[model samples]
Target: MENDCSRFVQKCHKCQIHGDLIKVPPTEPNAMMSPWPFAAWGMYFIGPIEPDASNKHCFILVTKDYFTKWVEVASYSSVTKKVVTDFVRNNIICQFGIPESIITDNGANLNSHLMKEMCAQFQITHQNSTAY
Candidate 1:
């Protein structure tokens, strides 16, 4: 039975390329449309910035100015509503004033009504990035 199974496996094309395959490109590579990167003067990415450490909590909330290459990083505890709000309040609103548009990851906390309300109150456009 083992000898028969081995003979059957050897006949399979998928198994034949054990290590001799080179550059087996996708057949339908151009069938999918590639996406262009989003352009925004001021953008923010609200997500986990660093690994969870024993003592320190780190979340990545980055605000970047496209023209100036200026970036602001907001560190928080996980991706919670309070932390996101605090990031906007302390890092965004207080430091660089109000941006025309605010970009954040499509996390649950970031997509909440409270976050929307905050953006509305501040007259800032809130844009969410698509998950790759």
Candidate 2:
């Protein structure tokens, strides 16, 4: 086993190796995208909470107005596509009409197909933050 592992390591190394370990270059950004100008507007952030005793998930939907710093929050249990869809449709959109966009953490529920469809139906732009 030890000999096999050494051979594997040798296979990974090439001539003219200068350092004690190998280094990899960072990945480049997507070429298809361009810089975006920040605009002052209202935005929503949605995310799930800790699981309860019954293993059910809780979701919080928060909205903040960029100019005034006004905020609002709504909670739900399931966090399913339908639940989140209905919540955004009725509570957020219906109350304030449509905002410039909605920002959300990269949760699975927020990235589902049904959520995308709902956003398309309401003509709302949805943006998700990348992992830090």
Candidate 3:
């Protein structure tokens, strides 16, 4: 039966390792509660996407304001601590004013000293999200 084959494959280490890769993207998390609009934001990065754009950008940086559900996005060839800091400075702070807090995953680029220093200088609380 189909079920029996699936079980047998699961038990076979070679089959499991050599099986067709799962192409489905994982589910995304929803925005959490924020005290006020532009007061808090969530930041994350998306890929090394296929067929680079004319500008050669293959990655995207995204941020969502928790309360307003407003999103800001930019494409980049590469993402670095300075790039993230500038994104927060020019896109978030300059456009909306200083936020009370910002949330990001524990990515090295996101949590780098540059980001930490910028947040500390601006007095913005930085929080890391844990995968559920």
Top candidate when judged by lDDT against the true structure: 3
Cα error of candidate 1 at position 80, Å = 0.6
TM-score of each: 0.56, 0.52, 0.75
- lDDT tens digits, residue span 1-132, model 2: 999977766777552365354566767975522123222223344445565425463666665655455566667665566766676677666776665566666777677798788778767678886765
lDDT of the structure predicted as candidate 2: 0.61
Model 3 residue 34 lDDT score? 88
The full ranking of all candidates by lDDT, starting with the best, is 3, 1, 2
Off by over 4 Å in 2: 1-59
* The 10-residue segment with the lowest total lDDT in model 2: 32-41
Weakest lDDT window of 10 consecutive positions for candidate 3 = 24-33
lDDT of 1 by residue, 1-132 (tens): 999988987898787868465777757645312122222334344445356655565666676665456677756566677776777778767876766666666777777788899889988788877876
Model 3 scores a TM of: 0.75
Pairs with backbone N, CA or C atoms under 3 Å apart (clashes), candidate 3: none
**Higher-ranked by lDDT: 2 or 3:** 3
Clashes (backbone N, CA, C under 3 Å), per candidate, total 1, 0, 0
Give each model's whole-structure lDDT. 0.66, 0.61, 0.94
What tens digits encode model 3's per-residue C-alpha lDDT throughout 23-112? 868889976678889999999999989999999999999999999999999999998989999999999999999999999998999999
Q: Judging by TM-score against the true structure, name the best candidate.
A: 3
Ranking of candidates on TM-score, top first: 3, 1, 2
